[model samples]
Target: MQIPVINRSRHALPEYQTAHAAGLDVRANLAAPVTLGPLQRALIPTGLFLEIPVGYEMQVRPRSGLAYKHGIGLVNSPGTIDADYRGELQVLLVNLSDQAFVVQDGERIAQLVVARHEVVAWQPVEALSETGRGAGGYGSTGSA
Candidate 1:
């Protein structure tokens, strides 16, 4: 699926690193480095504006390498970008480690995944069908 995008940054547009990659890596569009102290978070801009099609949304996710190596992660994991939004794409990054982490210009900070969604209509009812494990929630099943 081809998407209409406007890139104002000097860096190239976000692309898949591998042939089978599900998400495209997005870079930071900063003039200078931004340092994030431990447990600190910042909204970093990507200088990218996209026009997502209706019935679809863009998901902003964290890079596994950055999270594993530097404890850098997205404050809102898998942030949803609605199809109607026509603003600059920004990532909410946080430092989970004790040391400070610096985000450089054109650095790959997050990823974007375009997915289709369905709008559900609520059917108000008093009773519902029963299940084998009714109301079973967190840790309801035995640990294997």
Candidate 2:
């Protein structure tokens, strides 16, 4: 699906790295490098604004390479960007490692994936249907 986007940053628009890639790699649009000390978080902008079609939303996710190599991850694993939102796309990044990490301009910090969603209508029900393992909380099932 074709999306309408406005890129105000110096870098080009984000695109899929591979033919089968699901998410487009998003970069940081910073005037200067921002350093993230241990356990510190920052809201980095992308200088991008776009409109998503109704019934769909944009998901902001962390890159696996960054998480594995530098212990860099997103505060909100999969942040939702509503279809109605028309503001600059920003990422909430956190440094999980003990050392500091620098967020350079045009660095591939996060990814943006467009997803389809359903509008659910709440139905007032007296009770939910019983399952084979009813009310089974975490770790209730056997570890295989």
Candidate 3:
């Protein structure tokens, strides 16, 4: 699936790192480094704009290494970018660790996954059908 994109930053275009990777790595487009103190959050710009197709959306997710090592992650995990949006792609990152984290220009800060979705129509049913574990949630099932 081809999507139209505009890149205003000096960094290279986002791409998948491996053969079967589901997400493409996205970089930060900062002129200088941005430091995030512990528990602090910032909206990092990508300088990228896209025209996603109808019925499709882009998901912005955190990099595992950054999240595990530096406690750097997206404030809204798996953030959804609607197909109609035509603005610059910005990532909301937060430093969850005790120490500060610095985001540099061209650094792979997040990942983007393009996905297709379906719009559901409400049936307005009076009640839902029963299941083997009806109404069971959050540890209701055994760990096994």
TM-score of each: 0.96, 0.96, 0.96
lDDT minimum window of 10 residues, candidate 3: 135-144
Clash list (residue pairs), candidate 3: none
Q: Write the per-residue lDDT of candidate 3 for residues 27-78, one digit (tens) a residue.
A: 9999999999999999999999999999999999999999999999999999
Tens digit of lDDT per residue, candidate 1, span 77-97?
999999999999999999999
Please identify model 3 stretches exceeding 4 Å from their true place: none
Candidate 1 to truth, TM: 0.96
Better of 1 and 2 by lDDT: 1
Off by over 4 Å in 1: none
Candidate 2 colliding pairs: none
- How do the residues 4-57 of candidate 2 rate in per-residue lDDT, one tens digit apiece? 999999998998999999999999999999999999999999999989999999
